[model samples]
Target: MSPSDQVLGTSVEAGGATGGDWVLHPDRALPAEPGVRALAREILSAVSDLPIVSMHGHVPVEWFVENGSFGNPAELLVVPDHYLVRMLVSQGATPAELGVPTRTGSGVTAEADPREIWRRFCAGWHLFRGTPTRFWMETELVDIFGVTQRPSAETADAIYDRIQAVVDSPDFRPRALLDTFGIEVVSTTDPAWSDLAQHHRLAAEGLGDRVLPTFRPDAVLTLTSPTWIADVARLGEAAGVDTGSYAGYLEALRLQRERFKAAGARATDHGLATTDTTPLSDAEATRLYADALAGRVTPEGSTAFAGHMMFQMAAMAAEDHLVMQIHPGVLRDHDPAIAAAYGPDKGYDIPLAIEFAHGLRPLLNAFGHHPGFRAIAFTIDEDTYSRELAPLAGVYPGLKLGAPWWFLDAPDAMRRYREAVTETAGFFNTTGFVDDTRAFCSIPARHDLARRIDAGYLARLVTEHRLDLDEAVDTATYLAYRGPLEAYAELAS
Candidate 1:
């Protein structure tokens, strides 16, 4: 018998949900109190099986186009996930020991073996307790892979072998799994200069209508980035527009945005260190662009240029009807040494305090009331949720509060977000949940968790007599399915 069969004393079929030894409680994330839990259960039953509308995430488009077999368990589950890598690294495990390749893609390290990495992850599985990562991991293993035994040093090999067998099956490929998971729509972030060959291929294969791209022009907007010049040149080449002057650069960005829209992109995403959006005069912007191109731009000049570019992007979004998404307040690469060795997204990005009221005034004032513009603002600074973002989104027809993201995507944080923002922004002023994950297998788990949390929050409203049960169920349905569809309507196939 195989290890899984030996462990379970029978062959565990994939997606059987027959792992009595490792079952997820039906009301795992519902309220603990019996009365509240009952209400939560009622609320959850209404929307539990609603089709998933994943508006924003980082899953590669090529995964669906290729439909290739996933490798061993560790490579699929642990290696590519920066969240797992960062946590293990914090607990004295090296990235190399977690099957993470070096910058040069070389695997000549101590943890090059997939089985060894799986063992290491199992050994440290306790580190994920009470974390969202743990919740998703459990769901993926037990519900998807049909593992009867919990992951630990004792059962590492058995679980790994079982997971590997499941992953290698035809049922585990991306397109089939997307259908299995009931994902109605998903978006992948792409750079402005991208040729979108993968997106084209997926479209040609008829899967492209469900998987869409999001335009992310951060590198082109940030004048101080090391690749800014090269990115600008590439943008010019791709758009067939000269970027030698500020006017030409703006035109190039406009062309790229049009191309992305033609390729089924509904939104443009921006990540800023701050929320500043001060616009510049044509003359000043032109001068700064010239200085930046000549490599003589100062720090202050770069910040001004970035802020102006944000305003410009807003104007372009207003014209093109693409939903604008701004994610700010992150100080990326908190530790330069680790960044130098491991490259970007090793999970060292830290949040900084941000004030959105004054910082975003210029952009909001210019487009907040525009008939065609819509914007969603996301921040790691929870203080801004009620104090700044909610109040702004409450009044501005153009602005909507993005769901709690990054460090604040946990259960408690999400509950707090509902309490803080719902009073002012109300239900419709928010964009519902955005998984924003890179882990493909965790997509369904993440969405399920969000739905449960929303149900619980709505149950409290029903108990408080603030909303009737029918209204609560309708609201839950909108949050789970309709909200994202309406918010990103332009991307709909």
Candidate 2:
């Protein structure tokens, strides 16, 4: 809190003995069962340094194209990390102190040392204990930056200075780090109406082979979006199609999908309250479109239109090679005030009870058997993993279960998912891990956790002899890296 503590290069006493070189004893957190430990170690070694294929995330396009230095630690780490702020908020740490961008709030760093903000973060580091947050933070701190000491109130300033120095170095730029981190491919979610100019630039410069784009039409499809009708109209304009008719809307979507493909997008993403794969007749769809344009569409009508659109989008994907991904079961931005101020994805999104049994039947009925169609379904509803999702994916040629995500993106969640469905759906029936993050630095950390957790999960199977040790190691490595490339084939070569 004072300049007197500003010993930038000075050594400070770390509170914990496991500070220096504490690179998260990977797979050490799993349950201790006979033969489990040895098999886990084998699986971990197999996937220790495999390349990451991130098929879904919210990475800034400009970070790669612009390749500019992130200004400070708070800006790079705390400001964009929803997981960090979400945990911080739970522990009575305000966003203002953590340097979160908010509605006209005064952030810490009035003195602008950057180290002070990090010190504050370190002081509250205990709040993340027993959480995936702690796992990820420690991994990032040690593995990525080679920090020898655990972040604490005492060593916060010292570590901050070291990180600041590392951050400003040329090796820490987005593209450079992507290469260093062994990121084979990274994809970002973009609106269907987006120009994707940066993606074009990256492609033109050969960076497109790694930094890719995914079409996220959540805004255009969600009837709850304030500018739904306007968005549809703009979608029409962007796609060079007419907007006055229901047929024209479908045409617009097709054209936009083409445009996205041309702009280096090989995947389409939908985020909805549920996989409400309902069907609507042409007349009903036309009526809904008209009402939406007139701002007279009922909530029921909006839901119908969204459900209808899912089927329609699948139809498009059937014709194109674009992989369609469904992210269902989130009650997005539960905080009305936060929604009003910062909009969606401000760390207030909550998961709700969702049904996958009958909810996806209509869409599955329409598109599931099509050889040309592909859909990767993700759910917060773990109850469905074995009961519904596994059976469906096992049978449906086009369907693949997406990785455990959002609320269930933790280590336990990953292990539980593999245990629940891998027996029935098997490894090939499920798409592998996706970062699904807004934070850039956490990409490697997230992937590392998924890998280690998967290694540990497979180790149990190998120990039980449910799977051969060699195959378990291979599958674990695939889940960490290769499976993503296969699921997102067009994006990753």
Candidate 3:
């Protein structure tokens, strides 16, 4: 066996032996103790095949509307995935070598061939060891593409050819794969100013019920954003309401919410640097809006106005019945050079320490008890899970704890999340698993991992005599399918 084979635990010859048999263990992520593992297996068996309800994600809607075949393994698995790009770049790989397109209109050079990119990825596959990205990619390769080899330099060409052939088939098209993956409902995030043309196309093609759009208005709320003026103007055009004044801007947002409702959107998503929700008085907010429109808003003014917008968004959600989803604490575009060259979502986003209890106090006090309002709060700060968010969601009728998000979406973190939140907020107050990914193929794998982790968590509860076996099974079903459905109930209705 060659050194590559030694790294991959497979036999390889100079003539390229077809890797090894990589089996996805039945209890891949379950507890190692026999009793707990057995119980986990039982719980997992009950919910493993449950249909996915992905209520919040960043998947491009055009893929489903177009129903086109994927181009290559690298495009399908690497270039578009920030998780992979970030890891590879951390290991001294450049975006250009990985076929990542530049935002400056210069296309990826010929040297960034798909085959070469796959080889680079294979060479660096060891870097993802013990990471959720590794698990997701392994599942996609072995389960979805039926690849029998571990990714390595020697097996890169063979694995790429195998995946390429699979993607070339009609069965691998986006719509077909949706059915194959048993995805019941998937939501794609769209800007408030979006036309949702692809969403409309999906509806026309009878797929609207399965694939839906989510309203994300962050760009318009950031008063100091480079494109804030343009985004607000676009919102005005889309809603047919003048947005020159703060009152008209609020009205434009309301109209856009109604438009989204008509287009089957059931939720509005907010990505904030802070979860602050201090509402400014009407006159104060109007002044800030005018300053922003004139490109004269200060940093302090921007922060104050953005917080005010979050409060106003909750009020609108209460009236419009759009479930509010807040994922705060991310400092996006951490590296300005990378962002300027490769564009946002090239994976420089980093998490900040967040204090959600006081940060969310104003909004919760204002609308927490509203009958029409529903909110799901997600965080990368584990400290907030038990100390702040869970306690808040435990009491607030409108607030639900969103699943472990972004950096916390790994197996151990998820397990910790259930342990921390379930004690205070309980299962029902928590929204179910959300595969918040743009990597479409990883959706099933991510959801599958969540289910297994939840099962393991519940299995330990059963072992502790805290839950009956039948009750645990039922809860597993809810966490896998019903929780998200109930959280976004308006969409189903």
Candidate 4:
């Protein structure tokens, strides 16, 4: 049996805090004031166990396809998490010390011992204080795995062995854990060229509704990427359309979208440094495509082409009925050396100050009212919450504000999110709490944190007489479940 199959007694009950556990407080993220805390507890209890509706995430599809057991605690929790790695790196812990694999030709070899890596992580637990990474890891260890002892230099081995026992059980396999966690539907991010055979296989096995793919065309859409030409060719091959011409390229993308839709894709995700969505004339776009293929497209021309394609993508969503997800304003891989050593997304991407008002005006103006179109705008730039995104989402029929994303998906940031956007966009105009995580085991913890934060926010509303207890509980349920269902309703159709 895989380690995850050993079902002990229920370890996740409220108010189960013991001397052994790190954080099992019933009112973990609730308001501190007595009356507010009581009210928040009642509100949180209403939605605490709602089936998770994970509409956007990066959990690997192969985990479901293979139904494989996770290898070890470190592989499951440590190596893959940039949130943990980045923190340790900041505190003088080398990536090699934590077992973060270096890219080939980077001249650095990561540590191979899981126990040694876990020991380092446990010893450095103090570094995670006041961070969401600690919260999630604590919950994963204590609640999910039934770990009781605190992780420290002395207790690391004991904790590791206890977790290893459960992880070796059949119950710990990825598919079993889905039911164990009560996840209703989870989406995996897939590139545009993907065949989605694994998704299809899941459908054949009668699990299609539980796992879905999200179409992501960023590689093929970014005209300036070094691999752009090769990515475009792959897209053409996948779609069975020649992408040698601009018209053919657009057709290929549309065909790929159709394939993705057939494979149960409900949404398309884009990552951009800016949300500029200006269009180019057909002739101009055609000329740019030819120049790009011929290796003559200038840097200036590439930027214009990227913006033009964003407009085109919106147009495609309007026609194809895929919910659009755009997260802008991150300078990806801020440290070139780290990026070179660790291929991208090793948590070096830094947030930039961005203006959504003017940058997104063109796209919103064009497709904001399209009957078949819906877009969710996510930002790491907190400045834009009330200043730009909330106001835009408040007025636009086709747009909704996404949950606090990446660096902002934390306890205090979550409270700040509600405080900033609730007055403008209101609760229903936001997309609810999406974990947006690659760490599969942390999904429940992430969602739990968001719910606790929301419950506190709603309790405040009740105290202020803006809402009654019943209304607050109802909204809590909506934010946890129905809101995501509504935001990505295309998933059902």
CA lDDT of each candidate?
0.86, 0.78, 0.88, 0.88
Cα lDDT tens digits for candidate 2, 1-493 = 1111132233323321233644445445655774787777778877878888888989989888899988777778776888887886778865556665555442232234456667778888888888887887776666555566778898887777767776776657888778777788888888888777888889989987788888888777766578887888788888888878888878888888888887778799988776787878999988888877777867787888888888788878888879999878888888887655554666898888788769788878887887778889898889988899999999998899999988788988888999899889999898888878887878888887887788788888777788898899888877887788888775321
Which order, best to worst by lDDT? 4, 3, 1, 2
After the best TM-score superposition of candidate 2, give how far the Cα of residue 156 lies from its true spot, in angstroms. 1.8
Instruction: List where candidate 2 sits over 4 angstroms from the true fold.
Output: 1-23, 103-116, 491-493
Worst 10 residues of 1 by lDDT: 1-10
Model 4 segments more than 4 A misplaced: 1-23, 491-493
The best candidate by TM-score is 4
The model with the greatest lDDT is 4
After the best TM-score superposition of candidate 1, give how far the Cα of residue 350 lies from its true spot, in angstroms: 0.7
TM-score of each: 0.95, 0.91, 0.94, 0.97
By TM-score, the better pick of 3 and 4 is 4
RMSD of 2: 4.6
Cα error, residue 473 of model 1, in Å, equals: 0.4
> Cα lDDT of model 3 overall?
0.88
